[model samples]
Target: MTASSTTTPALAKEVALLAVLATLWGASYTFIRIGVETIPPITFIAARTLIAGGLLVAIIKMRGLSLPKDPAIWKRFFIQACINSVIPFTLIAWAEQTVNAGLATILNSTTPIFAFLLTVLITRHEAVTMRKLLGTIAGVIGISLIIGMEAFQGVGKELVAQLAIVAATISYAAAAIFGRGFKGLDPMMPAAGSMICGAVILIPVSLVVDQPWTIAPSADSLLALLGLSVFSTALAFVIYFRLIHTLGSVSTTSQAYLRVPIGVGIGVIFLGETLASTALTGLVFVVIGVAAMTFPSRKKTVPV
Candidate 1:
């Protein structure tokens, strides 16, 4: 079999996985909206991560996969948990209190732009190409357009809430680049470990801040929390790691673009939200700019 022919099916499978990832992640905003309606944000986030972490750890033990035992590695694992699970998760949940879920997801798509800029400025690992720089600029413009200048004009708390959502996007981007530190560990181990650490960290914070013992939740809210823990937090990370393994970071991150359309559809169908013409144009730009940023630019050279 020729190399190109052999590789085509692998590429096709990765694309399919990304599509599924996009759908799952897109629906997550809807689930978060449902969840936050009844449950306090900090408590809800902490509980979901805890449950998801416990589930993954159980699975790992059942499968007999060896997890790292070094205290140093464990520290990094804890940091990874904070970056990947704790901070951004909390930020997005709180931001969703005021911001629409769809718009929030669209802003979250700027994560790769942050990842790229961070890679260039912080690590000095990857050089900034003109295409990537242009893509980042366009993405910022697109996000600004989506939120609209008018929304910014006459606002008080709502404007700050929107800014918080944008800040969450920055956290996500930092997390993406920061997670590159986990290159040597088994992928599933890091996924499971960080979740476990996040649970540990969030438990104390959630107890003190949210005081779940006092806050009552409806049955529907409980179910939403279960879905968030099981599907969005646990299963989502597994699929994310699998995609990264198969397609690398660049391709896996491109799935962010798909979240916008998916979130928009969910918003209209479930939340009864109206879409503006301006939002549509901004969505198109975000989709295009993210695609431009993530599409593979490197071509394999043939050796004689």
Candidate 2:
């Protein structure tokens, strides 16, 4: 068999893996909305991370994976946890209060564009090309259109919330870049450790900030919280690791694009969301931009 044949199969697997990641992340917005309806945003995020962290730790133990014992590595893990889990998790929850899940998901989909720029600018790792540059431009335009159309009616506060969600995407981009540091560690162990640290930081903050014990939620909301903690946060991490192992970080994180469409589909089907023609046009641009940015460019000329 030729080397080219093997590479094609691997690329196919990477694409498929990213698609699964997209589905898991896209559904998270809906679950978050349901959970936050009765649970305070801080409480929901803290508890969600805590429970997911515990589950991940258990899975790591079962798999016999080891976390880094070095203090420096542990510190990095803590930072990654804070950036990837705690900050974005809480921010998105708070932002979702005023924003619908679909719109929030659309805003969050900007992670890849940010990741591309960060990789090129800060890390000096990847080169930016004309196609990717154009795609990133189109992606920004798409996001602007979506935000402009959806957020006009409730301008001031809603705009802030939308920007907060975009900030969460920036955090996610940083996390994706920062996560490269953990290449040598077993993915599960670092993943678990980070969540453990995140939960530690968030739990105290949630208790102090939200005082969630004072408020109780309806049974439906409670169930939603359970689903958010278990499925969205915990299981999602497990699947994410598998994808990361199969695809490189950039490929795996490309799931950010697909999340928006899935969120929109769920909104139309379940939440009864009605998109204006303008919003739909913007959605088309998003799809085009994602396809442009994520398609892996091939080099037929090999270096000797």
Candidate 3:
């Protein structure tokens, strides 16, 4: 078979995986919203990580894959767990108490913009380009547009909640950069280990703050939690890592753009939510910014 012919099927599979991963993550916001109606934030996040961690462990065992035993790697896993899972999950859950899940997902799409800026300003790992700079500015403007002036008048708590989601997105950006440290390790191991570590960290907090044993969650809430853990957390990671490995970071990160429409659709259909025209416009801007930042640059050919 020709190299080009062989590459086509692989690329198609990766695209399909990307679509599925986006859908899973999009559904996560909806599930979190449903779950947090009865389950407290800390307890909900704790359950999500613990359940997902257990499932990943089972998968690893079934596949005969072993996790790394290095203490340093474990330490990194803890750090990633905090930024990637524990902190963000808690913040999003809290934010969802006030913010709509669809809008939160739209705001969260700014992750790549934050990632690019962090790489330029903090990490100095990537050179700052005009395109990326413009995209970053556009994303901020988009967020402002999403949160219209009317939302701020006597709605400080709501604004703060929305900002919490932005903070969560920033944390996600940092995690994406930090995750590069695990390049040599099995991709699944970091995801599984970070989730386990996240659960460990959140357990004490949930016990103290939430005291989940006293609460009886509704059937819908319980089902939402299950879906979040299994579909969004565990299966999504499997597809995510596969796409990252196959398509490279730029293409994989494009899922952020795809997630917006899926999230908005699910929220509108399932929750009977309505979005303002301004919010939709802002979503377009955010998607455009993310696309600009993540789309691969073309190389110019020199005439021989």
Candidate 4:
């Protein structure tokens, strides 16, 4: 079998993981929304990191693979935590308390746009192609369609919350780009390490601000936190890091394209919201965009 043929199956597996990642995170919006309804964002996300981080660390131990003892690796883990989990996770959690999850999903789907720009201008390591650029545009268009233009009705009303989500989107893009540095390690190491680092930072703030002992969290909120911590965070981060290793940052972030539709679909089914006709069209654009960014471009060969 040729290299191309062998590579195809592996890429397909990775892409399938990408879709799973998207689904996990897409559902996280609702989790965050429910979680922040009764729980403070700081405490909620802090617990999320702590729970997810602890779980992954236990899993790593069970596998008989210890995390690297290098301080440099830990330092990188700390940095990744700040960019990937701490900033973005907290911001999104805080934002969803006020801004609706649909708009947040729409806003958050811009990761590829920022990733595309960062890859081309700052990193310049990845190939910058017109196809990828078009893919970036198409992804945004898809998100807007999937969420429906009506989702923007509260945009100006919640300016700060909206901007918070935008900032989170930028942070996510940077995280995907920065994640390339963790290439050599097992995907779980960075996933677990970063979550631990995030928990270390956020827990103190939560203690001071939220005072977890004082609050009585509702059953819905508690369940939401568990869901977010387990499925959307711990498991999702494993898949996320794997994709970053296999698919590159920009393509991995293309999962944000998928998240919008999946998020909306979740909301529709659970919340009794109606799906619009345009949403179907948007999904088509999304598939096209993700395909453009994800699949390896065939290099035209020179016949010798």
Best by lDDT: 3
Model 3 CA deviation exceeding 4 Å by range = 150-155, 300-304
In model 2, state the lDDT of residue 132: 88
Give lDDT per model, in order: 0.81, 0.80, 0.92, 0.83
Clashes of each: 0, 0, 0, 0
Q: Candidate 4, residues 36-120: lDDT per residue as tens digits?
A: 9999999999999999999999989998999999999999999999999999999999998877665566677667666667788
RMSD of 2: 2.8
TM-score to native of every candidate shown = 0.92, 0.89, 0.96, 0.81
Candidate 1 similarity to native, TM-score: 0.92
Among residues 3 or more apart in sequence or in different chains, the pairs in candidate 4 whose N, CA or C atoms overlap within 3 Å are none
lDDT of 2 by residue, 65-163 (tens): 656689998899899988898889889999888787887777777777887888888997887799889888887888788778547676688788888
lDDT per residue for candidate 1 within 1-304, as digits (tens), equals 8988999998998888788888888887777878888888889888988899888888778878878899988898898878777888888888777777787777777778778777788887877788888888888788778776647587666666667777877777787776777888777888888888998998899899888899888887788789878887778788888888889877788788877788778877988777567767777878877887888888898886
Relative to the true structure, candidate 2 reaches a TM of 0.89
Between prediction 1 and prediction 4, the one with superior lDDT is: 4
Model 1 clash count equals 0
Model 1 ranges with Cα > 4 A deviation:
1-10, 301-304
Tell me the TM-score of model 4: 0.81
* Residue-level lDDT for 151 in candidate 1: 72
